[model samples]
Target: MAKPTTEVALISVIVALFLVSTTFASSDAPFIVAHKKVSLNRLKSGAEKVSVSIDLYNQGTVTAYDVSLSDDSWTQDVFDLAGGNTSKSWERIDAGSLVSHSFVLESKVKTMFYGAPAVIKFRIPTKAALQEAYSTPMPPLDILADRPPEKKFEWAKMLLTKYGSLVSVISIVVLFVYLVATPSKSSALKGSKKRR
Candidate 1:
């Protein structure tokens, strides 16, 4: 009876290990990651030139199919698409690959607004349903603010304020090391007299 119980326990353990291994092996699905960046420049005609770019990466072992990117964070009344379309589609994104999309937006009105994250949709070969992901959200921005360019003196002042104390501390430490490492004049003269 005891021998039979031991065999049953061993069989169960082997079965559990097999199940765990298969579960890990079947996780070879495609994972999509996205990041969005926006840069604002004041155009000469008093309009805001907002250049937006989205970077997508596939970090899994399998390929993603029917990839679509949509970003409708800004409305037509507030902003206008100056260069590229807001939505894009791709046939496939292989593993360990990167894709990027960029669009230029132009706004004439001065406004402070918050933006939303872009949506990404893709399908895995083994899965029937589409998987959805989002890009990192952006912080609120004050477009067309009266921010003037810094002068040369202002740059110097900024550096001084940021590093003046650190420079002083480092100088003091070097001076202390020099004083400790070098013998004093009086000590050198005394040693010479003793030698004489």
Candidate 2:
């Protein structure tokens, strides 16, 4: 009786762990990641450029399609960010029913650069010209959540800009220690001097 009960419990635990692990597994789960960047030129005129990027993956037994640089408000148009990359792409696209469709973006950028960039919203719908792409619903972002946090990694900036004196003193101390550890030129020459 005890042995059977222990076996059942062990089997249950194994099944539960397998399910949990598979759920979080990278290859098994389908996910998409997007990287967007936008910049604004204070001196430039209202001229703007836009860049877009996309990455799609289908972990299940179906194909993902119709990937687009979709901001219905036409927002990603940034202006005068000289020689900047505005769009991103995936490494490669795999083929198969459960295949993932990754896309690269190169449209406009100035509009998407700021969260308040004319309030452009991005949506991934299930529209397709070749394959039936599934629609992915997007939830509204928290009004304040998108704002940059008041506290930031600003300490590094302070060290770079305002702590120059401290950095210089530390560098001087390090140089002194290095010099003391090294044999002096006079000492090295003394051993070879024949008469002097």
Candidate 3:
């Protein structure tokens, strides 16, 4: 019985040391800091184009492998990365490293507004470490529209389009009241002949 207890205690100590070493090793995993910016360009046809710029920094001791940016809002057909992307392998991002990428997305003028919500997903070395250092609800980019100046004729046309029917109806009523209130020329002549 004494020999069995000694063996059990030795095994427990070995397991504890292994766990402690593994924890220390994983603590040096890579950490990622991400930032994004969005901008809008108004086309000559009155359509808007969206451009997104992203910057990622690896602020850790180990290299981050397979780093990529992904979002459901990114339309596969219209999305264009600065450099052509053929595979998910982005090489490796070393410690204290900075990487920048830009993408041009499809135009969504009517739907795009100030402080629009967007989520960016990243593939990093360790999800837990990245999440701990990552900040949420990033500042939204402004959508600028270079609208043409409104002309006087355009304002007049808009007013007519909105209130033209009301104006016509009022004009007709005024004409009818004026005709009823005024004495006719023929009646005036008859009255003058009777008085003479």
RMSD of each: 14.8, 15.0, 19.3
Per-candidate TM equals 0.67, 0.26, 0.43
Error of 3 at 132 (Å): 9.9
Global lDDT of each candidate: 0.86, 0.38, 0.57
Number of the top TM-score candidate: 1
Worst 10 residues of 1 by lDDT: 15-24
What is the per-residue lDDT of model 2 for residues 82-193, given as tens digits with 9 covering 90 to 100? 4433332233233332222222223222222223211112222243233222123222222112245466768878887898888999999999999999999998898779
lDDT of model 3 at position 175:
97
TM-score ranking from best candidate downward:
1, 3, 2
lDDT of 3 by residue, 79-141 (tens): 434343312224677889987766565443444242322332334544643332221223333
| Count of clashes in candidate 1 | 0
**Which rank order by lDDT, best down to worst?**
1, 3, 2
Question: Which ranges in model 1 have alpha carbons more than 4 Å from their true place?
Answer: 1-26, 158-196
